[model samples]
Target: MITLWLFILIGAVIAFFWFGRQIAEAAQQHAVGQAEKLNVQLLSVACVKRRLAVLSNGRLGIKSQFAFEFSSDQQSAYTGTMHLENLRLKKMDIPPHRMG
Candidate 1:
């Protein structure tokens, strides 16, 4: 029984990281698309935060928030956020940045 429980725990840990990686990839794609649409350069996209919350659209999901750095003029750096819901982009909150 102890060995069986250990296997279950290990499986859960693996699944957790697997899902997290998938979510991070989706968030990165969303962030890149958003930055391109805004005519900014995506410097970096990192999965820096995560939470379980009900979205404003009234959907209960795992919210994976990625913090991204962007540059419009290739000089000034700016920060933005991309929110993902189970590997789907739920919302994007990017403040106005410089435009080149």
Candidate 2:
């Protein structure tokens, strides 16, 4: 019984990491798409923060927040944020960038 419990605990740890990785990938993809749509260059998208919270619809979910850096001319840098609810893009906040 002890060994069985240990195995279960190990499995849970692995699954948690796997899920986190998947969420990060999804956030990156969403960030890239947004940058393209806005005609800005995506410098980097990294999962800098995450939290569990009740969404607007009162549904409990993992809110994966990513901080992204972008540039319009590769000389100036700007910051942006992307929020995901269980791997689905819930919202994005990007400041105005200079146009080429």
Write model 1 residue lDDT over 10-57, tens digit each, in one string: 998898788888888888888878887898888999887887678667
Where does the lowest 10-residue lDDT sum fall in candidate 1? Answer: 52-61
Clashing pairs in 1: none
Report the number of clashing residue pairs per model. Answer: 0, 0
At residue 30, give the lDDT of candidate 1. 86
Tell me each candidate's TM-score. Answer: 0.85, 0.86
In model 2, where is the ten-residue run with the lowest total lDDT?
48-57
Q: What lDDT does each candidate get?
A: 0.82, 0.87
Compared with the true structure, model 2 gives a TM-score of: 0.86
Candidate 2 ranges beyond 4 A from true positions: 52-60
Highest-TM-score candidate: 2
lDDT of 1 at 31: 83
